[model samples]
Target: MLKITDLHVQLEEEDKKILKGVNLTVETGKVHAIMGPNGSGKSTLSYVLSGREGYEVTQGSAELDGEEILEMDPEERAAAGLFLAFQYPVEIPGVGNMTFLRTAVNAQRKARGQEEMSATDFLKEVRAKAKSLKIDADMLKRPVNVGFSGGEKKRNEILQMAMLEPRMCILDETDSGLDVDAMKLVADGVNALRDEGRSFLVITHYQRLLDHIKPDVVHIMADGRIIKTGGPELALEVENNGYADLLEGTA
Candidate 1:
């Protein structure tokens, strides 16, 4: 479960505020979707929660399973079961995909005081997860996201999520740049991992992705604040009317 209360964030080098009082809770075993227009701070909230630099938390706090994560380093947060699947997955050239993944998996295990998985176990696990996400062997042999298509990158992100098995997953627009088939494939991978012990916070601009991923709750965010909360129908409303009607007095 993730709990965010009155969270206010501002860019470190400027006077502009990005998240002004973002209070939301993602209960365990549930999927929560946040829909908003451009510059609404949806992505900013994801970065801030994952401990990305350049943004200062001016007020409030974010907690994962009742533990404060604001003070933890990025890797420390990962060790504590927090994962962010970026909208644009970065490319790390000259590093084999398997090598990068094994290092990350073992590093987190070391940080959590768990034994490192042997090469055989990791190989078995990664191959299974990659297959589920439709990641072929050739793709895994290449550098991370080096020549991957948009859908491949997103699927790779899901594969990371599956391999890590984080309790709270923040998917920052996993549907971005994905066509219908790719989106459905990605959603299937996400849905396969849903369980009573894991939760998801999906940030998106449209409802097509929600159609595939059926969120339990939907929130309308505008001007750095979550202004409205409702059920899955809320996403339908946004698709029907857009954010203009919802933004009438939210400014």
Candidate 2:
């Protein structure tokens, strides 16, 4: 569903490059796990794919189902069936979670030439999805991610993904700060969304989360490049031996 080829990226104000010729393809009905140490440009790939500003694409192309997404704005990307569950979800103090989600969902539907959902319909659908994700109704009525715990925030992101139903979803460090229970909740939400026409790129450092989601392909990224690709066993190997051996050989 997504293809990234020879993707090179650098911060505009800095001379240093982050991603150097990184390439990968995620097909529909599969999940890809990108495991890398800190500063490996894993998050950069997510940001660049989502069209965040300040990251210059020196060379490369990211295509979603044969359409180039590098030229699209962030909202356009979302409307084109791309979703990014951030590593650290931002808090919008004044925006209630329900209000924010309804706005986003309606906006995407409106862009697609569909009529906006009525408040009652949106509430019913969102409540069902949120309940499936184990998000409390009270949380939905509060400000987005404001005063929420780390696990709560991650669960909220998953709730958004479930509500959005994007064709390709990128989960960046969704397990970063969650407790075991929260991790399971987040993983369950992702698993529930997995299907034949959708794909996921899960960026994480630990193998624990993969045990629940079970990625179809595992990739090891370093120095802004994907140096190794393997099956689920690769994640176990990395967990057991760390990135040392992979880095030594690649270096």
Model 1 ranges with Cα > 4 A deviation: 249-251
Give the deviation of candidate 1 from the true structure as CA RMSD: 0.8
Clashes of each: 0, 0
lDDT of 1 at 217: 96
TM-scores of all predicted structures = 0.99, 0.99
What is candidate 2's CA lDDT for residue 146?
Answer: 99
Clashing residue pairs in candidate 1 (N, C-alpha, C atoms within 3 angstroms): none
Error of 2 at 206 (Å): 1.0
Question: Could you give candidate 1's per-residue lDDT for residues 98-139 as a string of tens digits?
Answer: 898999899999999999999999999999999988899999
